[model samples]
Target chain A: MQFGLSDSQLLLKDNARKFFASECPMASVRRLMETGTAYDAALWSKMAEQGYLGIIFPEEYDGAGLGKVDLIVLMEEAGRALLPGPFFSTVALAGAVLSEAATPEQKKRYLAPLCRGEARATVAFLETGASWNPADVRVASANGRLSGEKLFVTDAAAADFLLVVAREGVYVVQTKAAGVSIELMNGLDLTRPQYAVRLSGTPAEQLGNSEGLARGLQVGAAALAAELVGGMQRTLEMTVEYAKTRKQFGKPIGIFQAVQHQCADMYLETESARSAAYYAAWALEENSPDAEAAVSIAKLYASDAGRTVGNRGIQVHGGMGFTWENDVHLYYRRAKASETMLGDATFHRERLARLVIDAHGALAKSA
Target chain B: MDLNLSADERSFRNEFRTWLEANVPRDWPEWREKPLEESFDYLRAWQRKLYEGGWAAVSWPREYGGRSATLMQQAIFWEEMARLEAPPMANALGLGLIGPTIIAYGTEAQKKRFVPKILSAEEIWCQGFSEPNAGSDLASLQTEARLDGGHYVVNGQKVWTSYGWIGDWCELVVRTDPNVPKHKGLTVLLLNMKSPGVEVRPLRQMTGESEFNELFFRDVRVPVDNVLGQVNDGWNVAISTLMHERGSYGARLHLLFKRNINRLIELSRTFKHNGCPAAQNPLVRQKLAQCYAEIEIMRLNQLRAFSRITATGIPGPEGSIQKLFWSELNQRVQQVAQELLGPYGQLAKGDLLAVDNGIWSYGYLRTRGNTIEAGTSEVQRNIIGHFVLGLPRSY
Candidate 1:
């Protein structure tokens, strides 16, 4: 079986890299972080114009009728640029949930605006502790009314609507609806802000089923894995360049075996994470039986690799890496934040173990 | 990016599976016994049977009496073989290493003399590269091969020679020009194991098995025609042999790990911890799950490397990445299995009360070599550093 990306896919990736580099440089990320803006409206519009926001949406809904794999390619570039926005929240999470679980009328009303960049939305799944367990959902929905709080809801303050995960099912609640309170919280990753939203008897529409919730998570997690890979790839490139130019003693520090090994280890981590991420993206796109397992595997590896490689990126830069003036800390913060989001490495590992046990049944010997 | 096998490949796998079911003996040897000669003979006979069935050397080209399977089919063959928990071919070194090298660099006469015999298991092969002093830095090996009259008088020693005692031929690497640099002075000779001055002493490992041996050559005489490649180019030939040795074998090793983990999962269900099934223990379950993920990653990484090989004729330094990951992952898996076994883990293979006949215990000990052989973890990291990462050489 062929595993390499198609020629068109490769061309899209190259174009995305150039676009991100030229359009949304790290300076824009720093600017958004410093100004306390939820995101750059101009850049969001530019991205919508680039057809990235609708990369995975069907063309019938004013979108680019591409696959999830293509969306991942763009997401990777966004991550490399550290593009500050709710692109992941809107496209990968809420967008996926709507298309997968919503009725035709609901799609026309909800997903169409999201596809056309007329509205921003996000999925508010977890209530409190950073647990991704389905059983951890505590938001209650009954009789077309919603009352609960969603903690660490990403980009909620900037979104037009929120897909709230509730005990009964998912409810599409408007952010500005009465009896709703949205509080912005300072997060470890300044590039992507988090919010705490409280809803009290807010009127909402039922998505009818959580049919695609798992699919949504898989798509989201795979997208995030690609982002982590992009971040790590840049970290490695920066670390390598720094090592070659930065001299210590009589030669470049890269010549030192210890530093060289650290760089080598980072390279290994980044490449492995990329491989896992790519496979997960492809599997999720194809809806393969192994997609869920592949997502966990990719997320598990990328979560750990992101943190380790990012920390090593800073470590190799020595004192400069510790400073806010240096850009390495930006990726390090993003890495730490992303490592626990959706699910941590340990959490994914436990999920994977359960899957193995379930699949083996009597062969597993453990209930 | 389709990961599923194509129709042709699937059919090839089915045919191979049916053949195996029809031909493979139901009762196989559980473990090797003392004096090993009978078991070794049985193994050779099995290899011959496979060769006669045209299933041996599936990865080799058709001109060499092989099926010329594509990389994917070769991978499928190994995967199915490991799935059946099939015994390794008796002439693994010949089939995996020497045969490929000979095809790449041997003379017409050399190919005619050795190729078919290797496939038929009439002549088993072993490698003679690593010396006591030249382990990681193989080019520093001081084995001497002086041209005397019409023969080369070889006097050197090779350690960690798998199947040395039983092999009919040794792919020997020696220095023919002592005055030149370490890498340039070497030569490769197909040494007859029955030579007058040859000696083989088995080395006992931590697993209590003498699966490997040390070879001592005291002026073993070899005809000049025995050289496989050009004189003083043995270094390149040795590298070629190593590339073949490391390539695509990961698929087979991955299957073996998958099978062992399946067994461990079964054991976890049967075993108890804190008065409940051990599989119910969150910690043990997490450990097992971690093993499963790592093993899957090992397999996926091999597929990625396979893709690279398909794109480029050669496997690039990415082999070092998979090499480092899988070797370490294999050990971690066995460690998890041993931990799951609890008190039963300490039992030896033949102990009366041992679980799975103490296979886990033996496996735990045997995996110690997983990191050390082929290439040490340190050496792999070095390769990644210098070759893959373009870092300055530590040496």
Candidate 2:
């Protein structure tokens, strides 16, 4: 098994880090976190222009045709910026859903625009409490008009379209279409926006059926895991740097064994997150029989690790971490928000348990 | 770079796998009766098999019967062994730490006598480094070994000696002179455990198993030939042992807990209550998910170590990072397994139907000593943050 990053993965990561350090200002991150807006439109366009939004999609579809690792690099830098809105939800989720489950016709229509960032869409999968069970979808579908409410829909209010998961199937519905409604919800962290979606007879085009939706959700969940892995790594890296520069008790806090140990643990945490994220990213390379299990495992790791490193980042930064202005707090907020966005850590854990059982049974039969 | 093992390496790994399978004694249930003795026997047997197969002494010179295998191959061998569920090695003290130190600084006679014996497992060994007062500040060890004529009259105590009771020999650190800094005036001694006045008292731990013992040496005699390096200059020798401990050039430690996590998920499914499998519970699902996450992370940390070895042929102080994470993950996984058992977790085997066959409690007890072994997690983290990450050193 390949145990480390490929050269392209490393290059992609370095390039994203260079770009973010240059283009995405800390002040801009602070502003976005305060405003609860999606990323700056101009910068969003810049990412699109750089061919980053379509990183995990096909080159024919206007994507960079990169692996999960490549997009992961972008996600990490984006986390460093604490850029608000739906870069992850739309590009990572909506785009992934289209790439994975959409029919060829659907992909030709929606995938191209999404890859190019000409259109940004959000996923309405989590009905409540940030869980990712197909059964969790309260929003129902009937007569090509999807109705019911989707809760905690990340970036729902701002997106031009909604990729809704419902009992009837997975459908694409315009946010401004008939009977479509969105209400912004209060979130602990403002960097990522959330919404409550009420789809009352909203005109919709079905993209994938339940199975298709399940596959698509798997893709989205995995991509989100990859993103969180990146986020946790950069967040920890930034916090460690902050620990070195910040002084306490007449010495840099990093000198204290307590601080050093905490930073070391963060390093371990980030590394752990990276492994799962990278493996999930690699799943996009080939949708083999093992892909689903790999993705489930990865998502489980990233969501939990993202939250931990996020909280730890703030802790390592001390008082400034609690402040509204510091970048550390921004990452902490992203970690918290990312957890609930694409099925919290607990949801994937249960899915993993089921998969393990099923896998064991299969092995038993074969034996 | 991509992490593909080369064709040659792949073949090497396949050969190792085949060899282990063929050679692993059929009776693993009785392999290591005494933690120390069993480790020694199994390791010696394994080492002999490797030696006969021309695979032993991975990092030694060609003349010394070593393969000089690539660091990645060594890592692959360890991983493969873990995958195969082999018994633990016995001569780690000599092979991983002290033997490496001897090779680095020992005279030709010293190397000839010790290295081959260590590989053949002729003499089981334990570390006499950490003392009652000196652990993290290891240089402060007070086990005095005074040079008398051509021999050293050693007297004092070395604690936490893993398998000392079963060990035939001990790799010791003793104060040769008290006039210098704590780090200075210390000498490394390869002393026979059965030597006069040597005592090994088992100290039972929270796990109910005594993995290590408190070793006391009251005026034991060590020959001049037993000195690993120069008199009163062992701090440097000890440093190399620590380095070898981090690098792949050393002996292998069987980290078998990852398998436990996999097996646990399976057992949880079979454990049904109220006409439903325990796996159906959302809480069970979540804990499994979290365990999956822990396993992935643990694997990643190991991957980092593997990556460094792939390029540099050496594991730096950064090796401490992997060691720390693995230990912590082992502890956490065991902890979670019990926590997931709910109230039934409290019952052990043969206690009115233990939860999930009492697997969680068994695991929890076995891993209790993990945090203290190799090196404490606290000590490891400090090393990583400072030595590797370039943070300032704190006490």
Each model's DockQ score? 0.62, 0.47
lDDT of 2 at A138: 72
Residue lDDT tens for model 1, B71-185: 8888889887766756678899999889989999999999999999999999999999999999989999988999999999999899999989889999999999999999999
True contacts kept of each: 0.64, 0.71
Provide the global lDDT of candidate 1 against the true structure. Answer: 0.85
lDDT of 2: 0.73
Per-residue alpha-carbon lDDT of model 1 for A1-367, expressed as tens digits? Answer: 7676777788889998998898888887888887554477787888788888888988877789988778778878878878787988999888988878787888889998888888999999877765788788888876889998888888887799999888877889999999899987788988888888999999999885577787887889999998998899889888888888888887888877788878878987887787788889888878787788889989999999999999888999999888999898898888888898899998888778777775463223433
Worst 10 residues of 1 chain B by lDDT: B29-38
Residue A224 shift from truth in candidate 2, angstroms: 2.5
Best by lDDT: 1
